[model samples]
Target: MLKSNFARFAAVGLAAAALVSLGATAANAAPVPTEGPLYVYDGNGILIPTAGHVFDWNDNISASLSATDMAAPFHCSADATDSYTFLAPQGQELTRSAWQAYAPNGFTAEGSKDLLAFTLSPYQQTNGTQGVAKVNGGKWSLGLACTKDNGVNYASSGVWWLPVTVEAGTGKFTADPVGDPVVGSPATIDLEATTVPVAPDVDGPLSLNVPVGAKATLGAAALVNGLSTSTGKLGEFTVTDERALSKKGWTLTSSVADFVNGTNTIDKKQLGIKPIVVSGTAVAAAAQVAGSATGSAPFAELAPLAAVGTTKLNADLTFVAPKDSVVGTYTSKLTLTLASK
Candidate 1:
């Protein structure tokens, strides 16, 4: 239910519109509610052209731009070719990307956190069992920017963005030949089908056997040689997918709370983790994150698999406490989450 607002528009990497700064205020002030795909927002007395858009996933979502038409929105000139592109913010889990090409440009709106949402529905898999599918589809983004000069000598740019949900499609066709069609006269048949993208299911109601009472003695405070480390025995994680017909994949995520002992504290980022699949039918280990991640880097503590099957995941934990720290026993909680992609 939260919205992430973008900052001034700039298509530096997407296309050749880097000079088109949306933050360039015009010499004259314009009133708000300016009609068109773009609108003038009277930020105090500085007018700014702003816009928003939405698109569907798995489809060739695009928009045509003419210098003239684009100029109208931002009150610029149509003297040059319009610049445009669909920007995919880096570090975002695109899953099944639909962009025609990779867009290297991205921007972080103030206070914007990478947010994602999905709607699931119950359905029968091809194997004749119950399964879930994404109804609204996954989220992504599209970026647009264009600018021109006509004596205005000022950059007028606008942005179009919204939460886009893309869907995958499977098409099949059959030829209903009419009485043995000849080479010149071929039979014509039509085929059409629409279905939901099968959602992944977790084989859980299980638990990771994380070791209890993990300890990391500070290098200076270690009794038997200054070796400081704590290993966790997160119980064995098992992932079993009986639906061989489903193509959905999943990821196991690990996040932790800050280690704290009264007033003394250790950021969760200090805890290193490396998840690996010791035994599995079809599963791959995620890259070792080495204890570093933010909301934008969700994989710092994660286990990712490509194939569908039963797999057991485990992690190597190294809790490192810095020197000059309190001597109290700090406690922290570790959490593991399984999600479908």
Candidate 2:
């Protein structure tokens, strides 16, 4: 349900925009219900109101649209194509993006494909306010053949109105005060080691890196009550993409060898990991498959880090041993592969 901030506008004078309903069907002009299968979010990641929202600026790269592929009653089929065409207030079509894969129910992101960026520049909002134009983030065609299953499909145009208010964002931000610190005579100062060293000026290209000899600690392994599960942390690494704008996107994948100690061996599948993006926006981490535990999940190649620049990456390590296995020191090698797209 729409919690608050819902300001309804009469569908009163839309004659110039061609005659049609405000919703999916011509007879119904109301917005989709909160429980609707299709949901659209604004550039700030907030659910767009039924009547849509007002923006202070255009060129929003954070906007995304997602629709659920229903099952059972409203089987909208799997992997249906979703197309969105933003329309002008005068009913002229703006831009359109047609993606083939519709998300499964409750799926926020698939693999490294999470957010969809959008923009609406040259909108020209003046005099405090502008249009209440129709911007259909997307429309679901929900193959009607499956409606025989007695379930209704989200076959709406899923259109949202975008009105611009330029006056709301006229204020400029002030900088915070900064000054030198004055230490009291009684203050104690300890000299800590620093890693800042002089380096030659060089603009390197794409690179996968970690500080030299920077190894992570995965605490000692021990068996307790015949069930021994050791969890560890992977060292951090940096991925940099100084490539041209055309070659910006990249993917990161990992694979581990079997943990072995002479005659003892632990399957690589028994050792799972939890991938994490320490820093970087638009860098998603659904590349991990965690079922019961944090590190006990399958990791797929995902695209988050190195979106256009650098990213810090890490993963949680877990080793689940089989019952009656011999106890001994074991070791494994983890390999991370990076590729440009």
Best prediction by TM-score: 2
Candidate 2: pairs in clash: 73-151, 289-297
Candidate 2's C-alpha runs over 4 A off are 1-204, 222-226, 282-284, 287-307
Each candidate's lDDT (Cα)? 0.36, 0.40
- Please give, for residues 1-341, the per-residue lDDT of candidate 2 as tens digits: 21222332111212222223222222222222111122234455554432234333343322222322111122222322332223232222211111111122222244321213223332322211123221232221211111111111322223322222233233111111112111221223456786632223532376789778666656776765556777778877888766433444666767667778898887777665777778764354554432233323333233433335667788787676778667876777777777765
Q: Give per-residue CA lDDT, model 1, range 287-339, as digits (tens).
A: 43434633122331223344455567665666666556566677777666666
331 in model 1: Cα distance from truth in Å? Answer: 1.2
Worst ten in a row by lDDT for model 1: 116-125
Candidate 1 off by > 4 Å: 1-227, 281-307
Error of 2 at 242 (Å): 1.4
Measured with C-alpha atoms, the lDDT of residue 272 in candidate 1 is 66
